[model samples]
Target chain A: MTTERVDDATTLTDDERRTLAAIADRLIPAAHGMPSAADVVTDERLRFALNARPDLAEPLRQALRPELGPDLQARLDTLGADEPATLYALQLVIVGAYYTDAGVRDGIGYPGQVAITVRSWEYPQYLEDGLIDAVLARGPVWRDPATGTRARTDNAPNTYAERFGGTPPEGDTHGHDRA
Target chain B: MASEPADVLIIGAGASGAVVALRLAEAGFKVTCLEQGEWLNRADYPGNKLDWELKARKDWATSPNIRGLASDYPIVEDDTPVSPLMYNAVGGSTIIFAGAWPRALPSDFRVRSLDGIADDWPIDYFELLPYFYRTDKQFGISGLPGDPAYPPDTEDAPMPPLPIGAAGLKVARGMTKLGWHWWPEFNSINSTNYDGRRPCVQRSTCQSGCNEGAKASTDLTHWPKAIGLGATLITGARVSRIEHNDKALATGATWIDRDGAEHFQPAKVVVLAANAIGTPRLLLLSGLGNSSGLVGKRLMMHPFANVAGLFEEPLMSWAGQFGDLIESLEFYETDEKRGFVRGARWGLAPTGGPINTALPSRAGEQAWGPDHHLHVRSHLGHGANWGLFAEDLPDEANHITLSDTVTDASGIPAPEVHYRMSDNSRRMLDFHIERAKESMDAAGAYKIEVDRLMRYSGWHLLGTARMGDDPKTSVVDRWNRSHDVKNLYVVDGSCFVTSSGVNPTSTIVAIALRAADHMVETRFEQQVPA
Candidate 1:
């Protein structure tokens, strides 16, 4: 499937196409029932992107030249770490194209843009309610003042003082964190 | 060729220009508005398409240079730390704005007396309050009242505030723990169907133009009102130069039409609402309002940053309006001990779409291969982002000048912006980043990331031709009338004496209303200022 010649406006040589497919696969490899970038027709997307931004195609092709051998992942890792712009160019086309696929969105548990029904505004009670109690329970995340220790308190009006003890850092109220 | 004379001519049908046009037209004046870009219908918005996110990254991009639309003029931004981002449409940058409507604080106007750093505004906040209320009603602003962060006398928003989603709930709880003041954000978007426009359907694509006509861009509010009131609005009419008589009063302007034909419009009064960079560019090009040699000086771009958190639970931040709903202005005023004069407003933001999140982080941290897929999948609905709109003080060195080498399609010299974040701004950003991270941590975020400096978000362009009583130090007076060229006025962000610690759209519109009222009361059907 990866070897198939995808027809596009900007004609990429066979080697360029294969190299891009290999790079796309490495960038977003198929695993855990989710398809890889190549499986989501990234080659066709890249061709279209290249046709639109022709200036980026040559740099991408040049970036792939040194890594044209069997150890494609190693070269790609080096390129990704070393040449960021080239890697970003490749990743932008692949990731952007891959996410557009419905199967990929479903596989990744991304419920795409949902239509919102506008209604009268209401104060969301979930904040007062214990909807995020599980996360809050792992608290005492804020630091203490005199004790120099992290402490947690129930989400109450005077929670900051009850938890931290000894007056919160004055100045910018937020400066307490830096202190 | 010369055209028929009008009672009033306004340049750029943007936030300020549109309001001025509507108000003047309502005052029975023959008003003509020239806009550089065409009117974009709600149907033309990319939010209606499946590839909406893709369009946001390309054709409908916020940066004119990146979008490269025929309507966009080039900007040379090599010297600036952040590139200027704007849209050249009937509604201008408001088309891409997040509808974050925050008025400048009363202290913001008295910065010189309060902070002793920036100069004071010629007109104080009280003078602009009525206009604010009027424009808020027009925009159908939705917000909560009695936010302890603002001054006690602050008026309540017209419409009820938008719902604070799960992510906002987390942040609110976190702020409560930290004892920080947080409130529902004031939005220009309609909470319920009001003024013939639909309510925000929470598409989370406010930056890509609102498809539902919920977001109050001028095209939906002022433009239609102005047109209904018999105002002549010519789209695709780029004003090249402001024409003036021997006495140095503004006659009108010379503009280039869509077909590249030249036109000279003569008006009794001319208003330049062509934004900060644009207004200065025209003034300098035509040699209109440079008597004080400060036409394009003191450019300010609100330096900003974002702090993101990965939560254990599904926050589903991508479901609602992206940058609306909640904000914290606890740190809005100045604090001498914090090492910065003006502070920033922390607002809730989404983690963006799938592709944008999957891309390498600002610090160049890439989550790749099988591990990348797993990482992204796990973080899909479990992320929230908060942003800071920090104040960048006006500096004469940081300004807009005409680039001798760069010219746009119309052969007009492109604006070359030269700006660098001041030490004060850097200190403010550092504090903001720390506070944002602390809030995220308090929200139970296991993995936290901060883009210490937002280099690509130059949304608020202000203070080029600022308002001041001193003509030697300012371009316009208290009424937004150019001191050097009397009948000529500047009603945009260009007239902002100081860039406040918030979005300037609401204030921009309000200032325009106030300026128009002044014009009608004092100068309507009267002789041009001599």
Candidate 2:
């Protein structure tokens, strides 16, 4: 979303905020028992997202500018098709702001990227669960070429000479299956 | 340098360079490592912070081009879809790696013999066994022994395996239903307190650098011991070229510091431990190690794909380390019947945090409109992705060359990659995606989304400077020594003969250990240009 380097973290004016709110609502309206992007793009939440990713400030400002036109869906459609980068900044803040909301995070039952105390690794229960009894029955899956015994197995490649009775398949050094 | 010449000077103090430096220093040889990027503080890692996901999307992104840090150099990826993902810092790419540390199978060595394709490596898999064991401990690896997917020598990891959390168990069940070969992930991240580093706390922000030091990047595991052993590690020293003589012996290297000041550090021997891309760029710049005209040919980049599945359960898919969950090698070997010459491997990983899950870039479309919240709600803690890492057969076409237009901060020409995924790799990816979707189906996923090809997943860089017995066909010999330059060596992934289906870091470190130790074993016969 933060595409290029910028010297300063630009902020949106009051008119820009209104335009972004209208567009954010179109992008992520209240549906399926979820808060809209406009509902989630609160001052507190936007501030949090911007503080975490200050590089997005200029892109966010550019995405919401009035020069992009008044028809919200038309503006978004044009940006989505042609100016995808600007649209990326728009969605990152709108959607990113929506996800960063505490209520939204709680609704999804995601406590965030919290650290967990990892207990000592016990012997894998899969052994007792009989998950690999069938796998072990299939024997080894790899081919050991260092030892000649393993190389002679059914795992060895059936070469073109072995298959079609010719020299090593030639013509394409890049491994293209030339017809 | 102002001081007398060292016994060995290593360029690029990443995993390989760090290993070589420590071993040479312990053997009482004067060793010095020049790293382009500085030593990073643990606090700089985003894993421990509240805004970790925010950082992951921007400054801490895996692609150096996207991260755009001062230490990063431009890799002109215009010719290919696969973007080269690497860090230029002292820890190298490991700083941003997810730590899936599996050694290449024995068959990866003899591709020509077993698979009738790429040239067989001069050295065999068994030669790297001892070094693998040593490096497993050095990096504080963790896994269960006897995976049955590999040789019995596989696993036997130094520590217990990280927990196969709720998500892992779900995927493991899917593999079980399919009667496929699956194993708990083998990783360089610690499961227990190991070598004075903390155990993995399941922070899951592993790709953004592990702040807890649970992951064994070389900065934590090797550089400290090397420096303590009196090995010099000069950070922000970007090497320009290797200085060689008519005798075909490397004298030293000319490097530019942070202030653009150039200096030549002399050494009896020089080791290029820079990653696959950086090493070839330097070799092209130096105009040495190219007698075979293979200094930057035969590139293997292991094209990647992803299949993310959504389940009804909140599996805490964002809670644990990204990839150290479970892996299935059900189809990792060659299968002629599958319409592909080579095969691919699958590792079950957590779909990351809210920002990553909701990003429009992943789906290649806006996650806006009606499905905006529904998208995040479904994938946040309720989905897992099975990442397919397909073996890209070495092709002269998918090679690296010097870019005439693009340059780094110091005006040095950048490396340009001319990579296009082979027909074999595409078929392999297509085949794996179907199987992965089946696995997801067996796991009772309600919906499955496939990123058919990952454009930015060029993490494993290999085979640019291939190693073989014949000088005419390769850049280095069996022991990773440059055939053209007797006193020079390239021990990074550039020495890879074949790109294995699984991760390459484990093999990269083990090979470096063996080559550096071989130096210790044969120091008496070592030659110097000085």
Candidate 3:
């Protein structure tokens, strides 16, 4: 099956495009509701990278030559296993492009970029409300150097401990008390 | 070639050059700044664009070795593991820096006296304190007061620290658990609308240049002010060498413009604020400032590494400002038992954006295909990376010299950086790696990945033309005035006597301010001995 071209800036031939797509697919296979690299137009990203750094294109072209065989998977497997710098560069662009997709980012549960809109410069209320205390209660935690084996001494009213409350959970301090 | 005489001609329009220009011009001296790169406005900055990360990897890369723009000169960095990274622009490296604005510890000034390792700075922290305060106020620094890590001082940041994200909070708790001192990190970014600049909106791409002008890059903070105060800034003017008179004092500098036209700007005083590598290269080319035979010796790039901790919960590592929101200098002072003379400071950093995280590991680990997707899905948001900035001692072997073979677009010889991690640095890295792992473990991270061999981490380039009281041992004196060339001054990181473990921009600006103050007081009106 052929894919629609997303970018026309490349001088890559149809065979070269197919070879690149096959390699990209092998690099980032479809998984977890996310489209495979080839389906999501990663080839365009690869083409752009190749155009920018022309030195990478020849090695890729050589590695994916049809004379290397009709077996596309075998060609990709051989290329991947050989660990050429060209393969790494291709893999980088493929993966980078895949994640940059908004759909892919949402599918993977990443919030992407965010802007702080609150006008005031105060600390986030959640931190002061109870988050610090909750984290501290995950003890017996890493030992504070100033406090030694005991808990911190300067746990004032608005401090990490007092803000979240000073009660340790019953039984062992969970498995997180590594220190 | 326009041949107007200015009272002062600064070679670079970067960090120190901008500061000096502002101060000298404000003192009624005619100052002309010659910058090799173009003056970029907010529109020129890479804003919240979708391809911002690509911009960093391509056009706006911090290293000239990587970017190779026509405006940038090439450098031979193959000899050094950590490449000297900088941006050639009105603001220099600050245009691409993360703006982690930590001051050098007081002891950093007296390393030779206290630790008996590197030479002591000709000036001390106490002497530079007022300038530091001035710089902090100027930059509108954001930080929490009463950080137990620092020695008690009256100086407080202008604003509260940037909001500590979950990753920073987690790391702070981890440090607390490990019995270490951690505090809200000071940043050269405005937390609120200060002066005429807008507050930081947490764009998360400060390294790509702040389009909002929230970060205190000199172009945003000082250049416009200097220009308003009657300073002449000629961009695209690449200085080839400082021209000296028979009296051995610099009269002016000859530079090549963008059209390859050479112009000589005459000045009563010439200041070299062209960064560590650029300044020394020009001085050597001019055949001056080598009376001590130490023009480009004793280079230091603060050796650093990154440790990433993977957690089960999402911490949104890619969404906030890149500054170190939380940091620990508990190990910043000297500790003889660790088999090292000095220590390091580790700060909380994000695991980078999607593209950066998806890029293959520098250690040859493939982050591609189904395995790559699964790995990123499991770790991206859950990862918190720590940057460890360790002090690199001034070793004469680790130096920058003029390359005999390579030349830049200006037909000037490129800088050849020769550097290797000293034994002390290696030991410090090993120690810091272990400590970082412990901190991660304490933070309840299931897995920790440490890139101990950081090959691309040398952003803080320093100590090419060191300052001292003795002319036999140094290039410039305490006032940053060249010992050999009386009217010529070397300001910027090149005059740094020691490379502190923290970021050096704050210290660099403070030093420049102090030097400019001295120049205005004593020599602003002096004429060149024609």
Candidate 4:
């Protein structure tokens, strides 16, 4: 797995870096053609939102420690091991990154599962751009903080429609993932 | 602090407080308005999805600086059996609402009279109509005039109805075929042009916040006008307590800023428009609610669930306003056939983005994973969904109280919301879902997925600090003034006697405008300015 550094304001240590990757992978395990958890979880936008909520990070870290081992442990050690706030932020970013990723689009089983079939609609194009940015921009993190969790760099729906074509429709009829 | 003592002091710049302030201010008393949320501009609303959804790049520092004087509006394990309460900046809940504005039917105001259950509002639709017309004009609502499914129009909408998509058109046609009384729902959004405000661009992001001034949030309408009229809006200021004199009349208010400093604003009249949950919680926290003991009681929410369908062709769900082109009230009337008094309203809505798309269901679902990947290879693009917004009965047992267990940023107990649906509401929901399924089938849905009743889902909270004739029975009088505290007033959904089946923002604005007129004519001038 090719490791890319997460460009948070401060450069995370090697251990911190490994833990982020592991956490992201666990949140979204790559079992299909979408993309690897490692490839999609690196977005910088996703990392920042995780930092905002420290409480959610602890549960994430607790869930991942046994699976990730030393790389994850060293990151914890670097933060002096007791920083619940730090872990909470990291986990939120990891979960958020995993869920919204195009790979998870099929994994989460969104309706009509078809990717962009609408070649000319006004909105699909932006969704296509967002999908490309999500896939190619690599760190799964939101670039702009003001948009909070929904922030993305490609900010245009046309960009997404142009790139990915359309969302793939799900064959299953039970599409409840709406929060 | 002001130079002289006054009768009431209003806190927070939002839907509820703005209405209360306008009411008392119009009544001829000196009224002061306090807003903790930032005063944003039209430009502040960027037309970007990320910017709209996550509020990305919106200045967290410059945003509403109001801290929860009391933290976390908590939902107790016992009281709020299902949902959570969300806190927002200016405009209160109206800021984040989809602007699916609708008026309450005549029966909604007189629940006790028509249904023979629950208490009746001290006032009714007739009392609110003129004000409704005023606010609809001020807010610039849009719809086809006089659809007849609702009350007759007193004034035409500012803009024409938004164009209905294939799905909406299909639903409308199907409803018409079924002889159902269907019309485009009225909303406080500009479909064309109104009073210098632009119309909606069909961006479908109203729930996130309208970047365009089309949606009628208090921040865009009343609060801005109030500020222009010399109302001092202090953003990020969370009011902690309502200071009173020896006579127990409200004199001023104390709030905490983000920086943890306590600030005080002295006003003659105190209006609480923090919304259904916030208004009551704040009044309780201020120690001004016990006289009536109805500070945080009788909280109600219009519980909404959804039913989604997939057609052979694409519905292009995201092509319009968040919710406008579709409206249904097949189950709106009260009847024993449905085993409920009040009814539910259903609408066809576009699905939210991926993160919000998660739902609870049985197996064979393939939206995610390898099967979903394969499914996407065939069916992914065309999607349309329907929403079920049902009226929940007012259970005095459903309420908001201060929780001893949890606290927010400022160390006050979070408002604990204990809400349980009355059996009548459940029966109404079941009947409505069956009707919704029929509509979907009529619209030619090849495959459909409906949701269970989400009793606690919507944050459209109301009726806790209610308006009634008797102080013993309610928190405020018909004019939305507190019966117990002569000078104190409660606006917002909290003052709602019944949680109407429709969105409450338009009604909230109507009540506020009415109250403003009342205040200007009767109350404000009597107070000697300090």
Candidate 5:
């Protein structure tokens, strides 16, 4: 089902549109207790809103098109009927993909039913789980052993696993128990 | 010369000043208070939605939010730095603050000693506990008696807690699920009836001034009691300079009344309760505190940022005590791993009015458009917004000086606030963001859009004229008496040693109460040499 309305609004290219949808969903992914981020139509609505603010819009569009490729644009252009409905429906699917994508969800720390304040301090065990494999993803407690200081680590667990080439010791690999 | 000389002269009949006047007058000392702002009454408050922009329906000059010595108060500026001063009216900024009256945690009084950040206050919480109790009874605070969260649960609050709304429920559920601590916010507002004031109607416009007289701004709280004691209040008299002897002992002060006519009043003692920014600027500009040279240093602003969550249900933040609930103090303790010296308290702040909710950064264009309207109708109720008020460390760089360009109608240089977050503050913000995001997600928010961190300019601006052990490093001694002026005293947030991450009103009032008693004892009973 799609929204059945038409409005004369600034439009985003399919590539840019998809990227926006992906990021929005990554920030708030779908889960068991809540509606999927895609269901909210945050991306499509944001695009139409940003159309008036070109300074921000142009930068956003430029960032998205590289990942979207030409084929999706051609398909979107041919299938479009009512502008809002077509754009919105397209957004729903892309956002759905963004929410379901495990890697992206993990990168943004999209834990289901998050209690932000408690989680503000990371569970020592979660770091062991390699869930905190990235810097930006690390909460303040994730201290860098070498510097005797705090810094953000990388979110790419596979890259980390590759570099280390071995499973981390039991307590170091999964921070689930600590969480 | 014909003007009568009083035993004590108090400038600005506001919160701290009025309290001092009452205490002094009750002690049989003749007291006169001169206020530069209009003597607005309880009926003057205009409770409206437009208050978000206009700052509680106040005219910029007459408005307590905008009035200050360095800003609205008259001065001839020629590139010299000045600061924004507060109101010179009866009951000063207390006339315009959101009646969030949380007492300073005991750690607040001893932060420098406990955390090794700022200097220790002249007195500790234990010394001021009796005053805190007295003032709480006087103001009729609304809170529960015991929670084991922090301390001396003296008695049940004069009134019951305000009813928590949808926003409160969402925050409480989220916090409970996460095993975080929670409690009702202690407000200097009458939830039921106390001191002849009515209960709150939950108009949720307390910041714009409450017409119901439920929220205890001094106009409704302290003034009536103070006035009943035969104290005379002179409004719209802007204090300009402190007149003293060659010894720098304060004997009198000069001020310009509302008509721009100058009046000099003599007194045996003078009290400066003109708040943090104004108090120091007055001392510095009047050339009365040069011996200490610490009038405008160690300036601290409890810079706060809002971290909100968009929940799955309407939190109708506009409906009640701006969210009656607050979360645990589990994180209120500092840890070395967080790379911060102090801790922050998280609370549920409901900030979703038409203007604030529709921030260009947050709600975006969908705010007014058809989609935006739908989003608001659907998700605005779902607005489960919470915020983190972290304590910013005392950074010498974050000082309030005179602006180079802008000046108010009075020609005083606008207060040029130089504020930049320390690495510690940045780390605190990062931690707060992570927590805010987690709460939003935990509260079943379908989508969460968090605003990036920005400098919070207003929240108990303190420490410009900090109290300390040494004269050179401090403006006022521990008793809030100017080190240079033996008889002049500053009894406001200006005397704060550090800006704790909570509302400073209670602490300020407590300290002022203590100082008043001390002054009485010292002047009449015995003399302690500085």
Candidate 6:
């Protein structure tokens, strides 16, 4: 995404901010026990998303121009039908900022993605209760290409050294075999 | 005035190219690779950062037409239903792949022989079987063995299977309840510490890239090892076309750098390991290896769709390896009774974070006003999607051609795609979509949503330059040598004889390793430029 044509002039004027705020509220209103768009669509959050996608800055600015009328819902409908990219730009900025809001994420009881240290692998609880016993019992679904029948996978020689007539390298016999 | 030629020259550094470079270099051959894109730093992927979701919509988008980077080439895909998605980096499209590591089933090789439709592969599943074993360890694939989906693996995964988290558990329960086939999917992502890479923490941003380097993009899996064995890789060197001698043997390639400077790379043998579209485009541009007029024919991208189940329980669906939690091949084989010649494969994948729930980066449009929050709250962390990838059969009518009007930044003509979804693919997807919905319903979901025929789901680019015994129909032979040009090989997905109902990376690299091994076994007999 590092393109030469990216425009970095992102200092928004007061009028541009008002234009974006107006569109943001209509795109994501206050509902579903969540905070309003005003709480999430801050100038700072929008800028962060904008910086990550610098190529969108000029289009986003153009979308926030004085061309949009005050009838916000109707304006959105018009943009959705006529200028879809502009509407999409505004929507992307709003949704991006809304998720970044710490309060909103906390209120929703969702912590952002974080790395967890994996301990020794163990089968989860559900799998322990015969969940996949049926699958294991249904052996060897793959067909033999030569005969066009389900191959005898259980009784078949499982390695090159076995059926295909070659010796496997020393001590090699599992998914755990590292080259 | 030119430097001494290397033993082998590879025109890409993606999955197949990286593997060939590694294998040939290990065999003590002097190898050089030209990559259009530079190596990506694993840490720079948006998985760990704030505003990470937004990156998926813009910068990290899969379709190169959307990314608009200097490293990317524009594709004229207006005529096609599916876009040809690829990455031009050191690891290539593996940079953005989901790392689902399912090997092509045995039946997948003989589509023509078994089904009597497409042409049979000159080489069958057994030829590449040993290489798959070696390549699986090379990439550190994680999975449980003894699934009825395929022939049994001789050994267990080098590491343990990835934890099938809450979302996977629900989907697995549903599939098992129906007495259908489902198994913990084989993934190139690390489940435990293996191959010197950290285990996956399941951040679920796999499609964007693996920040923890848990997922095996070839840059991590093969390039470093290949370079260690003395394969010289030149980044920012976009190969314009394959160069050949008057004797019709490939010499090397003429490449253009980032600054628009041109240079000729000399080699005794040249390998075109670019993806299906890129390889065919390069060949078409150079006017080589198309004497059969099949260089850019028979394009096949898996006709892809998604079915999401919304449950009451907070599945925390956004918090795991998003690609291969569980896969079902219950309907993988063909059954003409279902009104289709072939079938589809299904994999359970976690839906993304809030922004993705509100407006999926690839899905078109979003709900606005009051309904926007409703859409967000209902799906944000409560859903798991079953990706339905139907096997798209090759049709000669569907193909890629060089665009007369379009070109890349370096002014190389962009490849134009002409793919039409077949009646078989359409019926296959329709039937699978309903079955997938039924599977979701079995999982105790309150509601199900279907995203049918998503345009951006065109990751599996294949079959444009297929391999066969017939020189009149195929681009490459069973050994992957171009029928028209000796010393020139195509070892990527381009040489796939048939499009299998699984991810192509494992098969691609495995076949490349087999080809590289063949080259080493018969090095003294290989033809080169005069």
Clashes of each: 2, 0, 7, 119, 40, 7
Number of the predicted model whose DockQ against the real structure is largest: 6
Candidate 5, overall lDDT? 0.58
How high is the lDDT of residue B512 in model 3?
94
lDDT of 1 at B247: 84
C-alpha lDDT (0 to 100) for residue B509 of candidate 1: 91
Candidate 6 Cα misplacement greater than 4 A, ranges: A3-10, A152-179, B360-365
Q: Please identify model 3 stretches exceeding 4 Å from their true place.
A: A1-8, A42-85, A118-120, A124-179, B524-527
Give per-model TM-scores: 0.88, 0.93, 0.89, 0.76, 0.70, 0.94
The CAPRI-style docking tier of model 3 reads incorrect
Q: Please give, as one word, the docking class of candidate 5.
A: incorrect
Candidates sorted on DockQ, descending? 6, 2, 1, 3, 4, 5
Clashing pairs in 2: none
Off by over 4 Å in 4: A1-63, A68-179, B1-8, B20-30, B40-47, B50-78, B289-292, B355-366, B374-381, B524-530
lDDT of 5 by residue, A113-161 (tens): 2111111112223224332233212223312223323323343223224
Winner by lDDT between candidate 2 and candidate 1: 2
Which has the better lDDT: candidate 1, or candidate 4? 1
Model 2 agreement with the true structure over B1-530: per-residue lDDT tens digits? 54468899999988899889999999999998889898888877877765677767678888888877778888998899899898878788888899998889888888888778887888877878989999998998877665666766633678767777888889889888888888888889987788888888888888988888888889999999998999998888888889988887898998888789888999999999998999999999999999999988888888899998889988888888764688998888777899987678898887787777777746574467778778777777888888999998999888899998999887789999999999989999999999999999999999988898888899999998999889999999888999999889999999999998888999999999999999999899988876
| Model 2 ranges with Cα > 4 A deviation | A1-10, A146-179, B1-4
Prediction 1 global C-alpha lDDT: 0.78
Give the Cα error of residue A155 in candidate 5, in Å: 46
Candidate 3: give the clashing pairs.
Answer: A27-B369, A28-B369, A142-B177, A143-B177, A143-B179, A144-B179, A145-B179
TM-score of the second chain in candidate 2 = 0.98
Worst 10 residues of 2 chain A by lDDT: A167-176
- Chain A of candidate 4 compared with the true chain A, TM-score: 0.35
Stretch of 10 with least lDDT, candidate 1 chain B: B145-154
Q: Each candidate's lDDT (Cα)?
A: 0.78, 0.82, 0.77, 0.59, 0.58, 0.82
Candidate chain B TM-scores, in order = 0.98, 0.98, 0.98, 0.89, 0.89, 0.98
